[model samples]
Every structure is written in C-alpha cells, then in structure tokens.
Target: MRRSRLGRFGSRLQSRSWPRFVPRFVPRFLRCLWPDTLFGRLVMILAIGMFAGQVLTSTIWFDTHESRTLEVPARLFASRLADTARLIALAPDDAARRALAQQLGDPKYQIAWIAAKAPGVDATSTAGFRREPIVQRVIGDLIRGVLARRLGAPPEIRLLEANVHDDSGKRGGILNLFDSPMPTGDFHVQLKLHGTGWSGWLDVRANEGQADALTEPHSLALDYLVRIYLIRFTAVCVLAFIAVRFAVQPLRQLAKAAEALGRNIHRPPLPVTGPSEVRSAAQSFNAMQQQLADSIAQRTRFLTAVSHDLRSPLTRLRLRAEMLPDPVWRERLRGDLDEMEAMVTSTLDAVQGIEITETRHEIDLDSMLEGLAQDLREAGHAVSIAGRAGRPVPGYPRNLKRCLQNLLDNAVRYGERADVQITDTGRSVRIVISDRGPGIADAALRERVFEPYVRLASKEGTGLGLTISRSIAAAHGGTLTLENRAERGLDAVLSLPRED
Candidate 1:
C-alpha cells in the first residue's frame, strides 16, 4: 500500500507542467537548505554567514550614528542657548542689548527670546520669566528648573537654534517644532536702572530649530554597506563555485574511468592527475586494474601451454597402447589415453578461447537457438526451442553459438531432452536451457565443475563446457549461472547485456 502511494505521488510529480525544472531546481534548493553535495553545502553555509554578518554590522552602524547625530546635537543646542542668555545680561544699554538680541534672533542661529522676569526679582514674578517656552521645552522640565534659577527670569524668553546639518555639514532645510501653550498673561520685564540710570528691555523666551545631524551620515553608511555587501557576495560566490568545480573534477574523472572498466575490464589504465590525494587514488586504481589483467593473462597462458604440451604425449601413448599384445590391456590403455586426449583438447580450447579477442556484431539469438535445435534434432537428439523469440543482441556470434551448443549437448547427452528458452529483460537478454538429467551434488554446485577432467557420476564428457560458456558470456559483458531445477534436472542461464 505504501509503495502504491509512493508510485502515485511520483507520477503526479513527474506529470507537473514544469516537470523538467523540478528535478534540477528542487534538489538544488534543498541542497542549498541542507546540502548533500560538498560544494553546494559549503556555499550555502558561507552565504548565510555573510548575510548575517552584514545585518549585524548594519544594525551597529545605524545605532551609533543615531546617537551621534540626534542626541549629541540636541545637547549642543541647549548649551548654546545658555551662552546667548549670558551675553544679553552683560550688555551696557538698551540699544546694545537689543542689538545682541537681534543677532541672537538671526535665522542662521535659529534663536528666539522671551523676557518675562528680571534679575534680583521676587520669586513669584520670577516664576513667569522662567516659564519661557522655547528654552524650557528644549531643556525639558528637570533641566529647566536648574537653569531658571541660575539665569533668572528676564523680560522675555531667548532661544537659539539652527537647521540640522547633512552628512557634509550643509543645512538640510527648515524643520518643524511644535510649541506648547504658555501660562496666562503675556508677561513682559523691564531692566531696573542702576545708580547710573541705564536700562534695557529683554525678551526672555528663546529656542533653537530642530536638527537631525546624525541621520544623513547614518543613511550614507548604510547605503555604502549594502553596496559593498552586494559586490563582495557576488565575488565570493563566483570564487567559491570555481574552487568547488576544480576540487570535484578529479572525482568526476574517477567515476568515468570506473564505468569504463566495468564495461570493459581490459580498458587502458587511467591517467592520474589533480590534487595529491586524488592522484594517489587514481594511481592505486590503475595499478589494481593492471594487476588483475596481468593475473588473468598469466593464468590463461599457463593453462594453454600445459594443455598443448600434454596432447602430443597423450597421442603417442594412445598409439603405443594399440600395439599391446593382450586385448583387454590394450583396450584399457586406449580408453585412458583417449580420455586424456579429450581432457587436453577441451582444456586448451577453454583457455585459449577465453583470451581470444573477437569483433562484436548484431545477432538474432532466437535464430541461432533455432538453428542449433535443428542441427541437434537432425543428429537424433530431442531438442526443442521454448518461450518467445527475443530481439537481436550484439555479441561474437560464433562464440555465443558454440557456447549454446555445448549447453544443449550436455542436456541431451545426460538428461535425454533439451529445452531452450530466450527472453528479453530490457537491460539484457536471458537464455535458459533445462534438462531432465540428475543434477550434481549441492556441495559441489560451485566447485570446479568446469575443470577439464572433473565430472559427476551421473554426467559424461569432458567438463570444460560450462567453463568455455562462461568465458564467452563474460567477454560479451554477461554471466552464466548453473543450478538444479527444483523438481528435477538442471538449468543453465546465460545473461548477456544489451549492446549500446
């Protein structure tokens, strides 16, 4: 049930409108989130880290700039107002005092003044002078209390201010400040005449314009930070991609070489290159392949030479045995010599054929099996072709025919009937031959049953047939397996991969 659900889900996924993009995009995005590949995961981690760092740095910069620009300038404006108040108190006459007040009121200074109290006055009247809106508002309630007693209430309130500076210290523009309503009555103050009779009028209310000096610098910094982040991110990603590709190139080459070896064991050794570790791995693989090839070649050569050398002596022995005087002795000697000769021939053929390089071509397996069956039937053996005829496969036709013949002969000679079946399994072709012969012991099923002189009590003939058949199958990128049928008899299965 679970498998059925999965199959349905797979079908749905594959049938989506943008199916092609799903495979490439989904896996990559998932890898970016929790990457399976080394390069992809590494890049993901680096990208996340860089982005986090940029955010953190930007936050710190904005906080620092806000404090420097807004808070610091607000305090400076308050200090400047105090200084202007002192200058008004020191002026000699009303004209000189008025001149100072006018200078203080200049738009560049952003200052205003209100005179509601005078120096050395009664506390009740002085309270009105201290209620100057612009100065008291800028300083706030607490600081206003301290400054009010120190500066005293003049005739009017004096305020000094200026437009906020941009990052480059240029005025941004006029800024708006809300004014709170003052207490009842427009209280005005007059300076008392000292013994000399000099007096002047004062306006005691004053304030500086609002300015956010920190904002421009903070914004500029953030902009620069964002630009730098973009450039660096791009450059780092490119460099990371290049480095990852370079690092993985050797692995890709190794995979290709491995696939080639699987297809053809005799393929030439791979060229070792890349980093030290990759080069070492390639060198080891090449060495192992060479050693395996050399070992196979050496065994084949040894078997061929031994078989060839034994044949001549066996032939001479058979001739000598025929000359023996006693009939039974001569017959016995002849049988032994013939058996030896047969073993030698089969062994030599199996060994030499294993190493024989043959040109591959397309061959109809069903046609070949039909022909073999016809030949065997004509020779008085009951051989039949079963199952569906499969598609033509590429192989050394003569070699494959010979191998099939050996299997059929074994079945007919021992089991009395041969049944051949051909099947196409998509990736490969399978040819199964079954017979009613008594199968060999299970203990020896995987033994050297293919050895030239080895044979089961219930079977006859030299035992190299299976060996030669398997070698042929292997040469064509396939395998041969032998097993006893569950009910009765033995089965030989030849599986050959489809040619590209």
Candidate 2:
C-alpha cells in the first residue's frame, strides 16, 4: 500500500525540477552530502525518514525492555531466598541450618549463616564506586519486597556496608538515573532466618548482571543498539534506491527522448507506456515531435518545388547568354545567371540539411579534413590544417563534409585564408577554424548573419552558408558557433559530442 502511494507521489515529483518544500539555504556540509541527481535525492529522502523512525521506536520501547531485563533475574533471586527460609524452618537445629546454607551455593554466590543483623538497609559507599549506589538500593528493595510476600512476613533484610562494586550503564543509563527502578549493581545481602531453637543471618553475595549490570555492561547495550540501527539503515538505503530508481525510470526515458528529438526531428515516436502520468507525457511529446516533423517536411517540399520550377527558366537564361554577341556581355550575363542558380541551389541545400537522408558512420575526422584541404588547394584557395581531428566521429559523413566546406569557403572568400585547429577530449571534439580577416565588430550582426538570405552589403554571396552549416551540425548532434577573434579575425568553433 505504501509502495503504491510512493509510486503515485513520485509520478508528480518526477516532472518537477526541484521540490518547492526543500529550503534553498541548506548548510554547506549537508549540501555536500546531498546528491545532484534526481534519483539520488529521492532515495536519500526516503532512507532518512525510515532511519529516523527506527531510532524513535528504539527510544520509546527501551524503558520497558530495561525493566524486563532487570526484573526476571531479581524475582528468581527472591524466590531462592524464600525457598532457603522454608528449608531452614524445617531444620532440627543450628547445625542442620548451617549445612543447608553450604549445600546449594553456586560458584558466583556465597551462602553462609551469620548472626542476625538489623532490619533496615545500607547501600552506601564513601568512594571506589563506579555503578550507582542508587541501583544497589533498588536491588535491595526488590529482593526484600518479593521475599517478604512469599514468607508471609517482612524480616530483617540488611545489605553489607562496603564499597558498592559496580559500573554505569552503556546507553541512556544516566538519563533515567533517579526515575528508573532497574538495578545495575550487585547485592551483598544479610538477612534473617530462623530454625527450631536456631536464629542466624543468611549472608550471601549475589553477582548479577542486571544488579551490577557488571556481566551485561552498558557498552554491550550500546553495541547492540548501534548494530541494529546500522543493519536497518543499510537496508533502508538499499530499498529506497531500488524503489525510487524503478519509479523514476520512465521519467529518465522521457527526458532522453526529448533531448534526442532536437537532434533527429524525424526519429521514431516515443513508446506510450508506463504509469498514466508518464504515458500522457510520452503521448504529448510524440505529438509535438510529429508536428515539428510535419512542419519541416512541408517547408522542404515548398523549397524543392520552387527550386525545380526556377530550373527551366535558369536553363533557358544560360542558353540565351551563350548567344550574346560581345564576349564581355556574355561573360557578365553568364555570371549573373550563375549567381541566380547558386542562390536556388543553396536554398535547396539548406532545406535538405534539415531532412538529412545520409546514414551515420564513423568517419576519420583527420583524413576527412585532409581531403577538404587537398580539394581547396586545387581550387586555388589558401587553407592550412594546424592540428589533428583526433577521433572517429559518428555522424553523416557527407553532410559533415559539406558543413565544413561552407565554413572554410566563407573564410577563404572574406579573410583570404583559412586555418583549422582541432582538439579532442573525453566528451567532445572541437574544431576551430580561424581566418585573418577584419572580424565582425557588432556581436548582434555576427549572430544575425546566420539567418537565411541576410548578408552584409559588401559580401558577394548568398547568406545561406552558415545557416546550412548550423542545420547540418544540429542534425549530427553538434553545434557551430562563431566568435570574433581578439586580434584580427573570426573563428568558427564546431563542437561535436563523441557519440551521436
């Protein structure tokens, strides 16, 4: 029943980033112990609650446990006294009474006859006492009280005047000191016994674990308490971890699907399963992903249709340019026609980048860059590769090559030179392409340049290059960002995760 409630509770909690009830200004040490992950935090909260409950239960019941521990042995000792008195009463004389005392004595106790002493008790010691004198007093009282009831009369039951030999209890002993009736010291008891024409003292020293708490010290009590708590604490942690992890699994899957959605707009829809809340979330997510896919598909089709329709006219224009009478006129007309055609081609390419059809594979990035540099050199463009690309990146090989080509070509066109640097780490591979040109001083314009068809007045080409490059990078689960170099250039930093 509790598990069902926890599952429902976690369903609501899983959707939130942080619980509002949790205070923001937790102590630094406590914050350090707190986990960063959602799953860990949930488990930690559950474990703490369970551990506190166990501690509380131990405290509430301990008084009862302590009383029971002290009473059982105490009653048995009183019973032994009652039995001894009855046997002494049946004895014929003092000689038989003395013999009975020595007959049933154990190694831990000394039972012998002495002259009958006073009726009152003396549980006092001036010094050299570890256990409480009060605990010895309780032992004296319990024994005298129980023994009297069995004998049908109260007798002289006095304790010896000596150093009260005992030690303090282990756990919570001091807390309950004066108020508790439990004995934690031994009994060197001197009591009265009568036989036929014989009267004397039954002097016995009973070393009980409860009376002295000597044989069963407080340290042992502490050990038991600690051991039980540790075992339960461990179990609580383990159980909490398992339960929260299972309950929050669907949430994690939903998050992963959302993250992957941005990378692959056309990827398969999420499975609509699990708890009702999670299933609803998945359905909403899949619907949103479908809407985005349809939007991109419709846009691609529009661009493709426009490009296709313009191709026939572009072909006719090229044919007409071929018939120009003057060479200068023909060349200029041909260049104008070529620029128009390039605009159409770039627009189509930009749309196609969003709908990448190329299969993913591991491409040797260094070799791919070498190929790009070799091609650019043949085309009379100045380009240099300064560092290695380091690792095989999993991506669309053709789309990634095209993306790099556009960035490098822009660098060559504006800056007159391109310099590429590569760096690799466990998480990502970064490629920084630098150019020695006058960088865009306006930060807003630098970002604005990535918008389709937006270009600086002086630039001699369509502004779709960066847009297409960024789209390809996004599709490959990477990023392409521009930074104006400090001294005199612009750097295109392309960072890609090692995995897709």
Candidate 3:
C-alpha cells in the first residue's frame, strides 16, 4: 500500500512544470565566483588595491612620527640635569655655598644642591642663612624644569647628610649633605657630583618639554595626511569607477547585442563608442549579429522555397492517386497524401514559430486551462481539470495556447484520457498534463526530445508537437519537459516564469 501511494506521489511530481519569470540570481553568483565580466573584476581589484595602499601608508607615518615626538625630549632633559649639577658644585664662597644649600633644600627646584661646612652641621638647619629668597628662586627654576607644562604648584623639599673624619681621627661635625626628596613627575634623574668630596644629590625632573612643542605640528601633519588620503582615495575610486565603466561599456553593449541577436536574428547593430579596443569589440559583435541574421534569413528562405515547391508535387500526387481504379488503394493513397500534407503544414508552422517574437501580457492561467479542457471535451476527448486557480502569468497568450493544445492533443491520442493540473510554485507557475498511457523510455530521458522532427514512439501525433511546445516555452523564458509517471502514464510539464 505504501509503495503504491509513493508511486502515485512520484507520478504527480514528475508531471509538475516550472514558471518563466523566476529571477536569475544564480547567474549573478556565478559572475562573482568566476568573474568573467570585466566591470566586476575591475571594481574588485580597485577596492583591494586601495585598501592595501591605505594600510601601508598609515603604518609608515605612525612609526616615523612616534619616535620624533615622544622619545627625543626625554633624553635631552636627563643630559641637561647632569651638566647643571656640575656647575653648582664649583660655587666660590661660604655665603654662596650657603645659598646653594638653601637652593638644594627648596621644594620648587627640579635639580637640588646641598653643602656642609663641617661634619656636625645639621642638614635641616636654617642658621646663618640670610639669602632665603635667592635660594627660593633657584629652587623654582628646578621645579619648572621638573614639571614643565604639567606643574600646578611647587613641591616640598628635604635634605639629608653623612659626617666625615680628618686624618687626626677628630670628626668634622657635618662633612657633607646631599639633596634628597626628588620631585616626581613623568621622568626623574639623580646625579652625584664627583670631587670636592661634597656629593651633591641632584634630583632632576626630566620633562624636557619637547612633546608640548611638537604636539601641534604633529597633529597638523596627521590631519594633512588624513585629508590627503581621503581626497586621493575618493578621486581614485571615482576615476576607477568611471574608467572601469567605460572599459566595460563596450562589453555590456556586446552582451546585449548578442542576447538581442539570439532573441531576434534581425536585431540592429551595436553602437560604436569608447576606446579603440571597445570599438573593436563592438564592431565584432555587430558583425557577428549580421552574420547570424543572414544565416537565419537564408535558412528561412530555403524552408519557404522548399515548402512552396513541394506543394505542387504533393497536389499532383494526390490527383494521380485519386484516379486509381481500386477504391481501397485510392483511399489508402488519399490518407497517406493527407498525412503528408498535414506533416508539411506542421513543419512550416514550427519553422515560422521560431521567428515569432513573444508578446508578453498578464494571462489568466486558470481560465486558459479551463477553456482548453472545454475545447478538448467538445472534441470528444476525456479530459479532467483539477487544482487551485492561480494568478495571471506574464506571457504570449496565443503561443501558450497553441503549445497547450499540442500537449493536450498528444495526451488524448496516446492515453485516451487527459488530466490537467495547475500549481503555483512561488517563483513560477507549473502546468502538469498527465496521460494514463504507457510511459516513455528511460534511455531517451536526457535527450533533446523537444527537437524538431523528434517524437516518442508511444505518442501518435505530429513530430513537431514537443518541439513547438519547447520553442513556445523558450520564447516565454520558460521550459517544457516530458517525464514517465511512476504509475501507468506519461506526463508533459510546461513551466512558465512568474513576474513576482
């Protein structure tokens, strides 16, 4: 039971047809993957190259600017602190000496100096120090160096010392005092002045101030770089797009011309424009179109001539056969002549059909199918119609009707019963014509069964029926297919593209 139901379902599926108006998205995908189109490849290349160039330029600019702006200033401040410490250690008198010690103890000094006359003189003592303001000024200068632009107020200061002894073993109270409590900022340098045996602890704040000076210049340079890059990139993109479009314009024309030629052999030549290469391609396409048109015209003329010439001979043959003495032989001869005449007419019709351009308009498919069924029924064929009524399909109504008539006629002749079904396949509309007859041979399934003068053995109809059907399908940008039903029949499917 399951097998039987499955067979029936398969039969129904085999009978289904497709629609004509399905979007060609798959072709676009193919173009992207293996970009045969000139415009596509050019745009892709331009985008990638621009991206790479921008990245390289930005990396080089950043590396060069970082070292110049940030690293050089810190080093210069450290060297200056060492030189300043040496200068202060060589001061001449005790008054000057005391002043230097006060300078060292001032909180504002970025580089501080300290001195001791004897071993026991307290490092923190302010005794006998009358020039405090001078000491404060010197300390302020050091603080300015330490903080640079960052200093909000002066910092606190501290002083420390170690005692020394002479050769007699009696110690000098305070031998030397060192500057301490370094002002902490971004950079700190400690310098120990040698000789004079008075180790001067120089705490130098090395905010060399170069970064503040360079900031505006570097920013301006970066801004200019960005603006230049943007302008260049925009210009390149626009130019590239235009150049690419111009380069590919001829190809686009060639493609359209080729398609038109295929659609209508007598299509006009493509316009010549753009560069020499583009003009050449356009010229070639035009030539090709002309050649194709000539070929088709020649073939059409030949078929017409042959068809006209054969008619007279066929008429004479019929006249001669009618004069035969035996009635049965005469009748048989007449029948044969009639069949020949029918075949000739069909052949001419099929040939002419190829030249017939599709006239697209919205056609009510359900009504068309119903009318076909009615006509077939009136002609005494057992035809059944089923399925939901669908929206109109955009196609040539006359050609579509003729194609359907052929399929229905064949179905009636072979199966002795015809069933027509319509379905909306979302992207397309499918028409399934099922005939309860012996199915087609599997060996010929993939063959071009719709070619002119080709017919299945089971189908007792004009050989051009399927060919005409397929031509009509192709004209409407659809397809016609024949398949064997899993049950006991053959199926003819006509698929028409939907607009939506």
Residue 115, model 3: Cα distance from true site in angstroms:
32
Error of 2 at 340 (Å): 6.0
What is the overall TM-score of model 3 with all chains considered together? 0.56
Per-model C-alpha lDDT, please?
0.63, 0.75, 0.62
- Residue lDDT tens for model 2, 203-291: 77665545334333465556655677877788889999899999999988888888877777766788988889988999999899889
Return the TM-score for each candidate structure: 0.51, 0.64, 0.56
Which 10 residues in a row give candidate 3 its minimum summed lDDT? 174-183
The digit string of per-residue lDDT tens for model 3 on 403-479 reads: 88888988898888899888887678888999988777674652566766766665455778788888778876788
Give candidate 1's error at residue 288 in angstroms.
Answer: 6.7
Q: How well is each residue in 6-97 modelled by candidate 1, as lDDT tens digits?
A: 99988987886642423453455453346557667667666767766876776555433333333334444435555665787677765666
Instruction: Report how far off residue 8 is in candidate 3 (Å).
Output: 53
lDDT of prediction 3: 0.62
Please list the residue runs of candidate 3 whose C-alpha ends up more than 4 Å from where it truly belongs after superposition: 1-40, 55-287, 441-448, 456-459
